[model samples]
Target: MAATKGSLSINSENIFPIIKKWLYSDHDIFFRELISNGCDAITKLKKLSLIGEYEFKDDEESELKVQVIANAKDKTLTFIDNGIGMTAEEIDEYINQIAFSGAEAFLEQYKDKTNEDQIIGHFGLGFYSAFMVADRVTIESLSYKEGSKAVKWECENGLEFSMDDCDKTDRGTKITLYLNDDSLEFANEFKAREIIHKYCSFMPVEIFLSNPNAEPEYDTIPESEVTDKDTVIETIVEEAKTEEKENEDGTKEVVEVSPATTKAKILKRPKSISNPVPLWTKHPNECTEEEYRQFYHEVFMDYKEPLFWIHLNMDYPFNLKGILYFPKINTEFESVEGVIKLYNNQVFIADNIKEVIPEFLMVLKGVIDCPDLPLNVSRSALQNDGFVKKISDYITKKVADKLSGMCKTDKENYEKYWDDISPFIKYGCLKDEKFCEKMSDYVLFKNIDDKFLTFKECLEKNKEAHENTIFYTTDPVQQSQYINMYRNENIDVVILKDAIDQPFITQLEQKNENVKFVRIDAELTNTFKEEVNEDELKEMTDKLTEAFKKALNRDTLDVKVEKMKDSSISSMITLSEESRRMQDMMKMYGMAGMDPSMFGGAGETLVLNSNNNLVKYIIDNPEGENTDLICKQLYDLAMISHTPLNPESMTAFIERSNKILEIITK
Candidate 1:
């Protein structure tokens, strides 16, 4: 045939520049686009073969694979795929037309034959993405049909093109890119491998990267051991070897040191960078825990083993397969941000796609491969559609079901992992209402006794003591005193240490109207008090309130005198649960500078134990010289117990304690 030359079948001359600059967000994405198209071609061939339309010869290269050959010296990168090659007329129809997807067209034509084959390309524009890095591109393809001649198509800057019959004999397409000066890095083998691993690590087709300019390497294996996919260079035989050795008893012995290899063949096949069939694609029962952990480590690079994981395999509503890992996150050290890789037909699209992965599940490290996702043009983001919401809802439901199921069936392991996974569950509850409702029953709280208890179990255990109220401690070390008081009274206090727990409990309160959460030091309960005469209690409270107010020089200070069972306890600070929550809300919104008094009844109170010697002395002698010093000392001590003392107050407290000690020595 004569050489044919013409401008590309596009209306505008500026289309190439537009595709190079504005079509894709990242230049590296060109690799994914071109590789995905190759995969689609191979997939179409498999479907045709499956339906018996295409026959595979026993001696031919029947293994479906994509080979990426990067030639740094030549400044070229080539993609060769042993798939269904296109005819000259087919190339003109698919390649000449812009935005016309060849995969979509083939799927349309073979709809009746194909059942579950995944076509990666939705728009033919992926081919043009090559212009993002290449100055010129060429394609050599031979149609799989009996007498179709090989066609070679070439274009400069994706504009004017030339087509002619070529000497190619292979029954597949080979695309070569003459990379531009600025994009020459892609021609480096290392860079090519990096790009392939980033986006095509899990592609449906086995992708192998090679540097054609590098020295060729080969391995010799037994002919019987060679697979159909291996490229054989030669076949040879090896002679057996024997060695003479002295036995333990000084007798000479002849032993075969190596066995003779028969029909050995030299083969060259680069290892595939892609795991075509990933762990997520398999049924849960067919997978092992070790495989799941290995997948987590490989995908997220998190060596710290996950607390547990949920393998989602669904087919009825929509095709979705994934493994969501509850990674063991040290919230104190590492960021709680988890990686959820989103994929289409095993090709990674993005990470942490909120449209498909529920926002709450972002703290989970996993991979979701859902070909049914409604991806937009670039496949970098998802289109705003209700189907995406359904996917997100399904993921949230799966997580909740996993947690609730574990709590029911694997109670021991559930409690074992409660500490590591509670923050995720709490954050999920805070973000998703349905998830919160589903997980409420399974949420476990760890008490001071190192025991895990459900909210219902805790409430029922303390029903007679503190009805419908849950007491929690933020810092077990700092609030050990308060916790001791609860323990002395035989009441359980759950530890809510994570920052997420603050909002989580608020949500819990809103959900259960009858329930309320209180910090351990929020108030002095009557359970810790010894019964005293009403008149005597009133007299002591009045005396102490006046004495403390006068001595501390703060008339507005709210003071209470409680005769405690633990007489050694001198003073304690009590802030109402309602007031503490108000303060916390203010801090969260950056209104912490505002006065706590702005919230009505939000002021803190100083509770003096009348049974203590310091309190009795101050009550009896309101005018005593040491009484003033004792008042300041007691207030500072109480402040330290409640929270960390400010620098100035901490300094003052130290000096006052030294002075008190001097007085005691005198």
Candidate 2:
């Protein structure tokens, strides 16, 4: 082949400048791109050998290795790799042509049924990322094929490039970068070593740093002395005959010689920082308890042994491997970011993969590895790719399956984790429809009496009496006074206190058929089942509202007096479920800091029970002088039963109680 010469000619004179300015944020990535190409070439050669297209020499051990050498005096950084080097023709075709990738062509031709492991590179732009940090780049390579001569290609600013033959004996490629003034930092050995360790630690080949004076380890030993037993015995016998050893003053004793001591040798071992065996890459069944616990601690330094773990290894729609842990949720602690780490080929891409996993799954602490995730020209590119979405769906389904199994086999344990996992599950149910549908069967609802039941079970237990309505309370302590009221009527009120419960319930109500979730403290909760005539109820409601307004100053009692069934309570202060839930959510999202004027609202409504005798007496005896005092007392009692009352209002009520006490004393 007569050199197959070619030149890279672009339409615009400013194209190289545009590429340098807009395409890459950093220039060091160029090294990654070039090294990746070398790896890809080696991978292709291996595949060719497997298919009998190429044969390796008996003496030639083919293993890819990347070498980085920095010349501070020359302001040059060289990245060398011993892999399948390109030929003169390949240089002309692949190197001379900008934006044209051999990897892309290989994938386009063989991607349909080819093994992905055999293909590593995609875009040729990785080479260009180097331009971000370098002013000039030179390539020196010799084709891996026998009888191929070495070639050299040089380019500056991607504008003009030259290629020629060079005398070389190596079967590999070397990329030398002339660092720009701004990128001199990468010319240091320490910086280069850091980059290699970070980006290429787990690369297919072992990367060696050229350390000329590397420290050597050795063991220290002490000399041991050999003793002559006969000589020692003769000396001891002479000493015993010549002199008597005396102890203190009165008694004579024989002296004995002490043996010499010897020191043990101490050996030094090489330090290893890399975790060669990643936990996710291992078989779940083969992993021991100690291994999983150690891995969890290594990944999350502060977290204790996880409550439980889920090892997911799936290769269907996409290849995925991960070990997810259900960390013990400390109710007192707030949520933290970066709990789940996302990995590509056993290397962590980032600790915070919020986009990869739903925000609700943030409570999960684990690692996820997927090799098929697509990266842009730079491996640094991170976005919600198709494979990521598919993997997320798979994980969600797996979690639901696990929970469902646990619920069936271990009800008590499942219930114990329900409160801790409820916030995450409810948030997911409210945001992700697919997850919601799958998780609906596993979500457990706890009643006021601390009994756990699934949604379906609760509905079945209360469908006939409550007319398919599910009544829940946000604060069980505040709503306990009304629990007996509902119990007397054989109605079950679910206890839900999580900040996300309101929105979750609303979403559930929308999805469920003919189902409603009414708060236990909502207006008309006591009369939900009453069957009264509209006109007669309206008359009784109006009379009661007027009487209460007169007995208690209307400004002091912000209430809605309504007629209820004879069995219902006399008066109760309640908050609308939606209003309360919205407020809770607002606080959760940091919206509560706004001025009160922004909300344009007052306090919640007070529902007065007209059927109670105490309320009826206060209404009928409006002429009595103590009517206002009695009405205020009743209002305070209702407010206390519904929720914690305002401190100022409680103080005023206390003073009023003291006055009544004084009267009784008189």
Candidate 3:
């Protein structure tokens, strides 16, 4: 065919900017798009061969491969694949025509009964993504059809491209990119290798990376597979894989034979930079536990083995396979991105996509390969797609099921790992209502005694004693007095220390009626003493309330006289749960011109233990200096229990304490 020049179909105006900037979210996606195209070409050819539409030579290798070579010095990169290549007319139909996918056409025609593989590219624009990081790109292809002319197509960063015949004799396509100065990093061997390992690590087809600076690598295959004369055979011992047999006699004999050695043939193989058989791609039963752990270590580069893993192999709803690992997360709220590598038929898409991964599952680290996800002309189209939502729900359900199973079968281990994974569970519950519903049963709370109990267990155990209220403490030290008071009464309080805990407790309250989470230091309810008369109780309460109000100059103080369960504690000051949370929010946001002292006055309630002797003395002696001095000191003590006093209050308390000490000494 004669050389011809023409403008690309889509843009009357130059659309290179659109392809470069808007085609993919990341500039590096160009690598995924181009590599996926190569993989697609290989898959299409294999499909044709399987269906008898194309014939394979008896001597030809059965497998197809993709090869990538990057030259940092030349600032050039080449992608080559031995698959179903395109003729001149095919190139014009696929390459020159913007967004017209030949792979889609072939899938439409031949995808009815395809199996064991997937065709990756649906949008022809994937090939044009090369322009994202390239000043110019050239494609040379030889079609699989007999006697077809090898064609070469060249395009700069412009609307027009030239297509002509080339002298390529092999049946494959080679795409070379002349990278621009700003995009020259793509031509670096290390950078290209990183991108390939990120995007194409688990691609079904083998991918080989080559660079001039690196030493050549030779691949050694099994001896049984070698048939070529040029192959150099070697022996590799397989330790721990001995063949054991019983002697002719009844007795067994120990024979120390060298470990089984595999007969191997060596070929100067291109540097294969992909794990063609990813753990997730294999059947779950076939994958060993150690293999799953090793795969996680290799993918994440974490030294610690994952605590456990869930292998998801679903074929029915929409081809989804994944391995989600639960890593030992010693840290939380630390901007750590849980890497759930998303893949479309082993080609890397993105990690932890909100549309595909539930927000709660984002803390998990693993890989999910789903080819059913729809892709259009651009990468941005991936977000908010219906298929993505379904996949996200499926993953969330899988995680919930795994957690529920663990809690049921391995209660001890579940309790052991509860502390580490609880934050993730709580966060998930707060973010996703569906996940919360599924995971509510497995949610566990850690008590002050370091015991783990489920929400229902805690509620059931303390429902009668605490009136269905769950007591919790944010800081054990700052609220030690309150904790001690509760411990004296043999009451257990759960620890809510995480940033997510407040919201999680709020969610539990909203979802579960008749359940309440009250901070240990906040809002102690009133209970009348069975021995004391109602008139005496009311009289002591009014006297103590008037004394504290006059002494602290906060007339709004709602004081209560409660016969204490313990004889030691004389008084306790508490605040409403809502008021305390509001104060926390104000402190967090640093709201100017607002004082916590304003809330301090109205939010506080003083609970006086009437059982203590000091409280009896204050109730009996009303207007004397002894009563006035003790009342001020008791009010300050209760204030200090709720929050540490400021410098002025501290100084006043110290001065008043010294005067009392001087009087006692004299």
lDDT of 1 at 645: 93
lDDT by residue (tens digit), candidate 3, 1-666: 877988878734434445777767788888888888888888788788778888878855445789998988788999999999998888888877677777778867765767545777766678888888887999999999988989899999946799988899999899999998899988888898888887888887889888876665566766676665445746564654445669778777666567555766575645468877899989998988889988998999988778888999999788999999888876743454578888878887777777887877778899988878875556434745677778888888888898999999998999988877888889888887888888888899889999888888888767667777899998887788898878766777999888879878888898889889999877654432335688989998999888777777775877878886666778778887877777777767886347556766345678888898888888887776688778888888887777788899899999999999999999
How close is every model to the real structure, measured as TM-score? 0.92, 0.71, 0.81
Best prediction by TM-score: 1
- lDDT (Cα, tens digit) per residue for candidate 2, span 1-666: 344344575434224443576665655555556656666776666666766666877745434456667666678887777777888778766766666678777667666646766355655556767777788989999877878989888888866777788876788888888988988888776787777655554455445554323343444333232222111111111222334577787799765564444433332322322343577887898899888999888668856667677898888778888888888766667563438877666544556565567777777888887778776555555665676677677888887777778888988888988887788778878778887877788899998778998888888877776677888887777787777777767788898887677778878788887888888776565444355567865665666666567755574445566666643466677766666655666687898755333565445666766667776776677657766777777778888888787889989889989987887799
- Model 1 has an lDDT value of 0.87
On the 0 to 100 scale, the lDDT of residue 598 in model 1 is 74
> Is 2 or 3 the stronger prediction by lDDT?
3
Please identify which of the two predictions, 1 or 3, would achieve the higher TM-score against the true structure. Answer: 1
lDDT of 3: 0.81
What C-alpha RMSD separates each model from the true structure?
Answer: 3.2, 8.9, 6.6
- How accurate locally, in lDDT, is each candidate? 0.87, 0.70, 0.81
Better of 1 and 3 by lDDT: 1
Report the lDDT tens digits of candidate 1 across residue range 153-224.
998987888899999988889999999999999999999888899999988889988887788888888889
Give every collision pair in model 1.
Answer: none
Error of 3 at 423 (Å): 3.1
Worst 10 residues of 2 by lDDT: 229-238
